[model samples]
Every structure is written in C-alpha cells, then in structure tokens.
Target: MRDYPLENRGAFPPHVAAGAGASISLAPVKGGFVIHLLGDAKSDEAALKKALAKIAPELGADVRKSAPNQWFWVGDADVSSDRLTEIQAGLPSQFALADQTHGRVRMRLSGPSSRTVLAKGTMVDLSADLFAIGQSAMTQIGHIGAMITRIEDDSFELIVLRSFAGSLWDELNHMAAEFR
Candidate 1:
C-alpha cells in the first residue's frame, strides 16, 4: 500500500509581480473562506440577510450577492468545521449553505490603474457613479468567470474557480502590462 500526503498551495506564486511603480497591484487573497448561500423561492434577500445576521454574527464576513437569493459570504479567516456546522444548522429552512472555501480563490487587484486593466476584459461599468463600493457583478474576465466586487475606489476583489484562478491571474498580468 502507498500513502500520500496533501499540501495546500495558492493559485499564484508566492512573490507575484506587480505593474511598474505598483500602478496596478495583483495578489492572491489566500487562506480565507468562501461560503455560498442559496435561498429557496420563498426566501427574499431581506429575509436571508436578517436571518444570517442573527445566526452568524461572529463571522464578520462580507456578503456579496451573486444572484437572486444567492450570496457569497467571504472573509479573511478560515472557518472551522464546528463553526460551519453551526452556521448551516442555524440557517432558516428555506436557505442552504455550501462551503466553497477550497473550491474558489480570491484575488485582490488594486492601485490607480485597476479599473483600466479590468475594463479591457469585462463590460461592467467600472465608473464610480455606476458601480459604487460594495457593488458586485458576476461576469467574465476574458474567458474566466468571476465575481468582481468593488472594495474601494481603486480596489477590486475577484472570486474565481480554483481551477481557473491561474489562467485569470495570467490574463490580468497581461492586461496590466501597458501600465508598466
């Protein structure tokens, strides 16, 4: 019999390069948690939000709407199994939770040129007046599907499938090259 050991690795290299003068910085948001929440037809956004706040107040996770009655609860800390179970059990009967911590990868793209780089690939209006802070759009960057959320005026967080993270990262680097 053979025994195998597993190791955790990030989607990008340890020291990923950024554009010249850091005009556009890109880095993997490793070691965090991504929880997908789905609500039934009878469950509305307001009800789900209220229930989640009452149930998992300690999580401090940023909630991003991915679709109607669907949201992704993201945080910068890894959640424990016991905590996850508690959250799952606390959800209302109309809501369900799926742990996507290991299934998805998050990347932070910031600096003044972040929007310019993203505009090259996605059609979402990155204008401040249109897509204000906390606004999230599930769209495609090049050929990769991702959730782009404006975390700040010059910063965006991208959540993509783990398998496609590397591809998306490479594409972002290329898109940001002209700024270098």
Candidate 2:
C-alpha cells in the first residue's frame, strides 16, 4: 500500500475533556508508530515474545492478534524511526515484517464519554466489562477500518489508516460535542 505521511500541525482543536457529568478527550499522540508482524504468531508467539523482550520490550505489552497469522505490534512515538528499522532487520527469518508507521493515524481518546462517542459506529461491544484495559480489536469506526485499544481505564488509542484519520476525527468530535 502507498503511504500518506502527514505533518503534525499541533494546532488542532481539543479532543479530550470533561463536562456535564460526561468526560472525554482526544489528543494527538506525537510519533505514534506501528509494525505489522504479519506471520505465524500462534506458532511462534513464545519465541517471538522472547526475542521482543530482549530487544524492544514495549512491543509485548499490547500485541494484538487480530487473526491467527496476523498480528500488529503497537509502538509509541517515543520509539524512534531508526530503531524500528533496526528491529525489522534483527527479526528471525520466519517472520514477515512491515513498517506500517506511516500508514496509520494515531489518536488518543480518553474519558467516560469517549466510549459513548466511539460506540456509535463501532461493531464490537465496547462495554468495559467486555473490553477491559489493555485489550484491542480491529474494527470499523465511521465505516473506516480501525484498531481500538483500551490503553487505560477510560482511555483508548484509535489507530486508523492515514487516509481516514481526518474524517474519523471529525466524526468523533461531532459525536463528542453533545457532552462538551
């Protein structure tokens, strides 16, 4: 897939907040990156986890298995692009890795109202009772393919393909306006 890299304007409107007994916020997380470890994770999960522990331990924290052979490693902006290159080269030969860093738009949504706004279009049941913290799923938001991960009790990182980020942000903000 072609990459659509975007410049961080740093002047977008606030996306996270609390008001009227409802709370939520959206913030641009700088340097959000991802690596698609698209391979046999089920067979090599233990070994892959071991290698990651020695190299980049943060990867093991939220490794989402969207399918039997498809896994995506979520990484924060703190992880440098150069480091991503290094890790890709160091992986075992059985693995097929792709640098999806520039392919996604990463946004953090937090607050009690955040889930409500997201649930409007999400297909999965997002009840905290079902999707607790640290859990993630590949689903659609605003009919756009998205990966939602509850990184905190009331916070989630919604990573969408770059092309859909802006529209998704607008849809999310529109839904959030009710609580704002």
Candidate 3:
C-alpha cells in the first residue's frame, strides 16, 4: 500500500519583494484565524460587537463588517479548538459562528504607493479621506471577491478565498511593477 503525506503550506509565497527601496510590497498574513460571525436579523452591529467583546475579550480579533448582520473576526494568533468551542457556546442565541481560518487567506499590501497599485484592480475609492483607517469594504479586485480593510494610513489588508489568493497576488504584483 502507498501512503500519501500532505504538508501544510501557505496559499502563496511568503513574501514578494517589489524591488530595492520599493514603494509597494505584498505579503501573505499566515498563521492567523478568520472566523465568520452572523447575527440574527434583530441584532445590530453595535449589539453584536458588545456581545462579542464579552465572550472573547482576550481574542483581540479585528471585527470587519462583511454585511449588515455579518462580520469577519480576524486575529494574528492561532485559536485552539477548545477555545473556539468556548466562544461558540458563549455566543448569544441570535448569533452563529463558523470558522473560516483555512478557507480564507489574508494579504498585506503596504507602502506609500499601495493605494495606487490597488486602484488598478478595485473600484472602491482608496482615497484616505473616503476610506479612512479601520474601514473595511467587501469589493472585487479584478475578478476576485475580497475584503479590503484600511489598517493604517498607508497600509491595507485584503482577505480573499484561499483558492483565489494566488491569482490576486499576481494581479497586485503586476499592478505594482511600475513602482518597483
């Protein structure tokens, strides 16, 4: 009998260097968790957020709005199954939780020219004033569906399906070539 062993790997390369002193850079944000939270029709963002804070005070996850009653809770630490179960059990009866850590991948596109590079693929206005820090938008980048979050004045995080990560990474790299 033949045995097959599978190794864990990231969706794309660890890091892509734009160039020397490049004005734009792209990198995969691995080893973290992505949890999808859905609130009942009666629950509002404020109520959900308040409830979430009580249930997972130490999780330190960034709650990014995906829709009116939906949000993606993301963090840079890996969560154990026991901990996940605890969170689920603590949730209010009006909310549902689904772990999407493996199904979704995150990418960080940063630097002075990051917005300019992203503009080539997305229609969302990347202007600082319009898309201020901490704001998130679920939009299309080229043909891939992604959630773009402004994490800083010159940095953005893009969350995409694991399968589409490579294509999106390539497209972003191409768009940033001029600045490299």
RMSD of every prediction: 3.7, 3.6, 4.0
Q: Which parts of model 3 have CA positions greater than 4 angstroms off? A: 1-8
- Record all residue pairs in model 2 with backbone atoms less than 3 Å apart, i.e. clashing: 15-25, 15-26, 16-25, 16-26, 17-24, 17-25, 31-77
All candidates in order of TM-score, best leading: 3, 1, 2
Tens-place lDDT per residue, model 1, 102-134, is 789899999999999999999999999999999
Instruction: List, residue by residue over 60-123, the lDDT tens digit for candidate 3.
Output: 7479999988999999877776778788898888888888887899999999999998898899
Against the true structure, candidate 3 has what lDDT?
A: 0.86
On lDDT, the stronger of 1 and 2 is 1
Best by lDDT: 3
| Model 2, runs deviating above 4 Å | 1-22, 58-61, 77-82
TM-score of candidate 3 to 2 decimals: 0.92
Per-residue lDDT of model 2, residues 57-161, tens digit only: 755535666667667777664555566667767777676767666677688888877788888888788888999987888899877889898988788888788
Ranked by TM-score, the better of candidates 1 and 2 is 1
